[model samples]
Target: MTIDEQQASVAVIGLGKIGLTLAAVFATNGYYIFGADKNKEVVASINQGKSHINNEPGLDQLVSDAVENNQMRATSDNVEAVAHSSIIVVIVPVLVDTANQIDYQMIDAVVEDIAKGIKKGSLVIFETTLPPGDTKNRFGKRIEERSGLRLGTDFYLAYSPERVYSNRIIEDLEKYPKVVGGINEKSLLLASTFYKQALNCQLIEVSSIETAEFSKVAECVYRDVNIALANELAQFADQTGVNISEVIVASNSQPYSHIHSPGIGVGGHCIPIYPYFFINKGLNQGLTPLAREVNDGMAAYAISQVKKEVGSLANRNVLILGLSYRENVKEPTKSTTLLLIDQLLNMNANVFVNDPLFSDREIHAFGVTPLSLQDKSISKIDIIILQAYHDDYKNLNFKDFTNCKLLFDGRNQLKQEDIKKHGITYQSIGQQSEKGEW
Candidate 1:
């Protein structure tokens, strides 16, 4: 089939954050979208015009309109998705194991299911982040073996990484330039043409599938290293009574310098885990592992700083403000808040957690006592740690914590002077502490 005669039907394999957003985008662009997931509840929710994942701006209304207009539908049947669509986009997650290796089981299973119904003239594109050489070797080989078809001749295969933030997925998908690489020339042309028609954004075509795979991982590693540098500098600033935030702002004013902020630690699915995709591939890069170590150890380091200020955490009431990795998203994948809570409990501190994105049941499910922001018990807390910079807590009334002694801003979410004006001892990630009476 030629590019001019290609069908407008598209299939998205996963129904998580990225997958659902992609399905919605395609539906909005006048394509028939078949959104597939293994979870029956997720499929049912989408079919009913309700979003399973919450807190994403404008996603709910877009999904509702798609379902109402008969442009999008969700199902658990993989064969049904492949049989109906000419273009199949796989956006399933590729996770890393505890041994710092890419776990191939999830992607392998997804490919096996796709092979059952992939047609001869279809285009298969993977948007999952992967180590180099996995797409051309492992994924292409599995689909060919199952379907008994040639890759370049029978069908097209390509890899395009999903470069999007959780809260701003739709905007990023439309605004950012998309990178695509394929197994062959024909495959690259087909994938690029399809995305250009759907998204109408700038499309960058690279040489091979490995290049595209490594491009996304390389972007994450770049941020991880820069963040590790800022975090290491914050440790030094804390010991010497220096303000690291001020130094970073001044340094970034120069044209040659671009530094990220230092936080309690890096979190979310990308920054904390993407380095391991290259480290376990037998590369001789030492700085990658070192950066991971520094970022990973930041949670414990934050606990030590709290102990230094409060003398001891034994029997003290500690409240953590946010549980999700970032603000306004309900994703806790590899979040540093989990690590913070673990160490605080080990130090014999009474831990309480609160996040407006989550309910009391969800907070308690993480194995901590849940507290509402409006609860009167917050006034009696000994220390309050702000783990995420959620907008709900940004303009909070600091006077509510009447009995609180120390306020630790893990994300630098509040101003030191404003917090101190309430007569509470305020501490931040990379700021010099002022000696004053609370």
Candidate 2:
């Protein structure tokens, strides 16, 4: 089909934060987007113009507009989404195992389902992060075998990884440059054309889908390794009684080598896991071991710092401020915030959590009761752990936590003076403090 003659029907599988944002973007750009999810409740919520996951800003209104304009439809059945669309985008999660091994089972399952109903001439794009050969070996081959059609000639396949941050989904989607690669030139041209139509940023084309996959992994790996470096520096500084946050600020003034500031731990779905994927690949192929150790050690390091800061963990009323991996988004999947909470609870600490985005149902699932900032019962909490740095917590009054003396700022969410003025003992990774009373 000619570029302009191509139909604008796009099917987005896996309607999580990334998938829903992608579907919303395409639908806003005038594509008829059909979103499919296995969870019936998620599908029902989307159909009603409600978002079960709170990541993208103005999503309910966007989904509502899409539904009313007949540009978007959601369904629990994969067959319906696949049958209605000329392009299929897979945005599922590909998680790492306990041993830090890559698991492509979710990607394989989605590919198999899409293969059964995927049209001959439709385009297939895998936005999920995977190792080198999954796109060509696992997904492309399975679809070709199931449909009995050539990959490049009969159908198009590509990998265009999602890059938008959970905090700024809509803004980042429009601003972030997308990297796309396909098995052949025709597939590349067509996929590039499709993405350029919706996205305002530049579209970079690479040689193969593996290169595209590596590019996505490379972006995340850089962040992970840098974060690991920051974590390492923080650990070293704590031992030497040096204020590492001030060191980072002074060192970053060089302009050429700006390092990432340290936090309690690296939380979030992509950063902590993406480097592990590359590390796993390297170890399988007999490579260096430094990257894996540094990144993996960081999470434990942050938790250890929390323990050290709190002094005594036994029977302390610890209030974890944020549950989501990062700020502004309501997603706790693969978050280190929860990991720290679990560790604290295992040590028999009384953990009360609060997240503006999460519901009481989710809080109960973690065996903890949710508390609002205005809750009267939390006035006597012992420790306040600032895990995720949401906007709401940034400017919070000192009087709110007046009863609490120990504050662990995981994300450096609070100003230096604010913590000091409140007469609270505060400690954050890599950050320095002014000379004041504790």
- In candidate 2, how many Å is residue 44 off? 2.7
Clashes of each: 0, 1
lDDT of 1: 0.88
Candidate 2 Cα errors over 4 Å, as ranges? 1-4, 50-55, 284-292, 295-310, 400-403, 432-438
lDDT of 1 by residue, 1-438 (tens): 333477558999999988998899888877899999999999999999998877677899889999999999999998899889988999988888767677888778889988998989888999999888888789898899999989988988999999998878899998999999999999999899888877878998999999999999999999999999999999898878878888998999999999899998888879888888888887546888899999989888888877788789999999998899877778787788998888988988999999998889998998999998789988888998888889898788878888888888888768877778777888877774764331
* Per-prediction TM-score: 0.96, 0.90
- Best-fitting candidate, scored by lDDT: 1
lDDT accuracy of residue 123 in candidate 1: 89
Q: What TM-score does candidate 1 get on C-alpha atoms?
A: 0.96
**Candidate 2 residue-wise lDDT, 269-329, digit = tens:** 7887777666766643322245446655555666566666556678888888888887887
For all candidates in order, the CA lDDT equals 0.88, 0.79
Error of 1 at 331 (Å): 0.9
Could you give the C-alpha RMSD of every candidate to the true structure, in order shown? 1.8, 2.8
